[model samples]
Target: MPKADSKFISCKPSKHGSTLEGLAPSTVLKHSLLILFCKDPSTEEPSVSGAETGIFDASRSFHSQRSLIEQQTKDSLQVEKELHLAKSQLLSKKIEDLRREECRCLLLKRRGTELACQILASKSEIDALEARHQAAECEYRQREIEELEEKEKTRDEFYNLRMSELEEFKESIRRFLLDNRDKVQKLQDSVSENTCDLLAMQLVLCNVMPMQLKSTLNLLQGSDGYMDNGRIAAAETKKSELLAEKEKLEKYLISSDHLRTLLQKKLHKMLISQDKKKTKALTKDQVEK
Candidate 1:
């Protein structure tokens, strides 16, 4: 029994073996004894002594128990090694999956950053375009204002010149009336006199032939008899001068009217051209948007 227990102690549990390492030595002995009982002896035991047979059985059982314990230890060690290997493989796979997930997340973050940069760049471009459009519009309006101011200045100058001409004309007309007043008074005085007195008055006021004067005086007497030939001639001459001056004024008025019409037409054409340009620019801008 002591030898059997010593042999069983030699069967040390494997470091990486199963929980069965705690099985009692008594259980191993029982198993071995059961194996012996179940087997048939090679020789008939009738001639054998009881003590020798018991000794033989005990020796055989010890050998069997030793072999069984060794085989069980080997199997438990193998199973434990396999379990550890399987656990290692599972942990490695999980780590690999985590690494792949981390890489995917990093790539996605980089792509998002690139997209944000592109969006900001596009927004800046749009802002610049808008600024340019506003500047162009402001410049166009400024040019239009300057053109209108220039036209107004030209119109003011034209009006000022026309007014000055009218002032000169009025002055000339007043001077002309003053110079002719004495002559007109003399002619009126002479018209009331007889032929001899008229002849004397004509010679003093104006150089005239007696025959012509007598014919003019008789023609005057036939009518209201207040007007003479000198006064009539002076009136006709004054009417001619006034008619000529009126014709000149009419021609100037007509020319000014034609100039104003031409200027208006030009202004309308320029406005239409500006509108067409603006429409084309707006159309292009819309297409870009």
Candidate 2:
């Protein structure tokens, strides 16, 4: 039923009772009229008083039936109102639960978005750090290579310098050896000349000494007669000249002895130097081979 149709129509109990009483009288009058119209045509005419009493009984039964029908309709309307209220409450509860679920979903989605952003930021930082590490590694390798190259270059230059110094030293030693040899040859020539001069002086002395001895013997044999003065004076002059020549030869011999000693010392030093040079040359040749 519609809401308005189900609404109660109010009436005072005393007034309703009086209206039903008045309605009973009017219903009896209508029933009397129906009985008058239904009388048998073939039978004797019915009495007015009897028909009026039957109409009154029928009107009382009709009022009782109408009251029962009205009471049943009121009970049915009360049950329907109770059922509608229960359904409205159930629908309201469902709507509230749906609202709560939607709020929960929104919160979860927002949190998830924040987490995703954080993850991306962390990944980017890792990538940047890796790039820096690689660049540092490359720079370190470059420095090591440069250092090795520089060391190699310096080593080459030092080796070349050492070789040049060795060559110059070898040249100086050769020059010194040649000069020493020349000096020794000149000294040998001087010693030989001095020896030849001493031998010639000795030959002259041997001849002059025999002549002086013969003159002395003749002087001793002719002592009884007066000696010739001219002969004696000539022998004396010749003896003085021979004695002076012998004295000069003795001085030259002493000087030659000192020269010979000096020459021997020089030869010893030259021999030692030559032996050292030969050994050095052999060692150098071995190294070259």
Candidate 3:
């Protein structure tokens, strides 16, 4: 019923325009004729009058039916046009909704691409930083290794020098012992003879002492057998002292060699530990990057 009423309103103006051409005059003429017919009766026979009244009633009923049909036709046309307009508006709204949805989908795709690009860039930077950190760690480890090697080399050289000096001192002691052996043997022979004057004459005969000694030598020349008495023993004592010092230095060198070996082992272990530590640190830094 509401739909039908809305249709009537929409058709009111057009119907009014069309009806203005003839409907208004026709309605006035029809009403005027009805009034005239009601006022005046026929002047024919009574039977004719009754027939005339019936005819007038039939004509009035036909005009009312025609006017009702016209109103119904206008109402139907208005209802159809209103329905069409509503359908067009619904279709437009649906199209607009679809367009908005399409725009939203496009925006979502663009944002996804942007996020992917950002992730890729971040990953690239992280990789680069990790590589640089590993390189720096490697450089630092190499330097530590070089420094350890240098220190060990210097220590070895020092030990070698000390050993060489000890060997040289040992050789000097051996030579001194050899020279003293001869002097001690000769002195023992002379003292076994028990001839002070015989030794003096033997010294002159053997030309062991110079016939004309310098004044400084004459003052200390204890009858030409000075070296045959205590000189050999004194020289042996001095040589033994020097040999002791050389022996002590040799012992120290041996101890130092042992220490060097221990140091080498320790250094090797430390280097391995350092390598492990550096590797772990590099891995951590890479992950952080």
Candidate 4:
């Protein structure tokens, strides 16, 4: 029996590859020999008690180690979950920032495009306006030049007409003076011939014939009539000279009228030129504004 106890006490818990066989709880309680071993009546059977104590100790150590491992695993899992949530949040924020930047860039690009279009439209409008202004200026200058030429032409025409009229009036006065001079010379010659005939008749006979005397007296009467006519002709000549002087004055007046017309035309041209200058200045001012 002592040999059997020693053999049972030497048995160790399962730490090796194969398990050692043991009795069931019901079997051990029912057996009388097993009960004697738990009592440990003899001090020499202490190894036998050590066997049971070792088994209890090994089970408690295993349970404690398992609990520690389970708690450590739970903590690690919680930390990992927290880290993953943080990463997800950071990525979401980054995506939102990228979307906002893209939206801002698109808006800026659209604004730039609109500004370019507006600049182009304004440039085109300015070009068209400048072209219209240039055309108007050209047309205005052409009209001004034509008006000046027409005015000069009219001045020359009026001057020429006045000159022709003056020449015609001078010629008429000269003809009238020549005709009056010819008539006066003819009357003077007839009076001188009658005086010579009367002197010859007195020398030839103391008494002249009655009929001849009557004819001589009639000649004297005719000479008197001619002298009256000469006086009237001299008065008419003075009248003609006065009329010629009046006509000359009238011709000078017509020339004055033509000169006045020319002066008016020049003044009108000057006014037009001033207007053109003002228009050009106004156009420049508007462009600057």
Model 4 misplacement above 4 A: 1-70, 162-289
TM-score of every candidate? 0.36, 0.36, 0.34, 0.39
Candidate 1 similarity to native, TM-score: 0.36
Q: How many backbone clashes does candidate 3 have?
A: 0
The deviation in Å at residue 60 for candidate 4 is 5.2
For candidate 2, the lDDT comes to 0.62
lDDT by residue for model 2 (1-289), tens: 2221121122112433421234466554543443334432223223334444455455445545655777777777777777777777777777777777878888888888888888888889889899999999999999989988898788667656756775676576567657756765665666567557656766766875676567665775668656767776876787787668667766766765677677677767766876786677568657746
Candidate 3, lDDT over the whole model:
0.58
Show where candidate 2 strays beyond 4 Å.
1-93, 166-289
Residues forming the 10-long window of minimal summed lDDT in candidate 4? 37-46
Q: What lDDT tens digits, residue by residue, belong to model 1 across residues 1-289?
A: 2234434333323456522245576665553454345433343234444533564467577657867988898888888888888888888888898998899899999999999999999999999999999999999999999999999798667756755764575566456545544544454343333334534543653543445557667878888868766877975686567557556655655555565566557656655765675576567557746
lDDT of model 3 at residue 3? 26
Top candidate by TM-score: 4
Q: After superposition, how far is residue 149 of candidate 2 from its true place, in Å?
A: 2.5
Q: Candidate 3 — which residues are off by over 4 angstroms? A: 1-80, 158-289
- Write the residue-wise lDDT of candidate 3 on 129-155 in tens digits: 999999999998999899989987886
Instruction: Candidate 1: list runs displaced more than 4 Å.
Output: 1-86, 165-289
Q: CA lDDT, every prediction? A: 0.62, 0.62, 0.58, 0.59
Sorting all predicted structures by TM-score, with the top scorer first, yields 4, 2, 1, 3
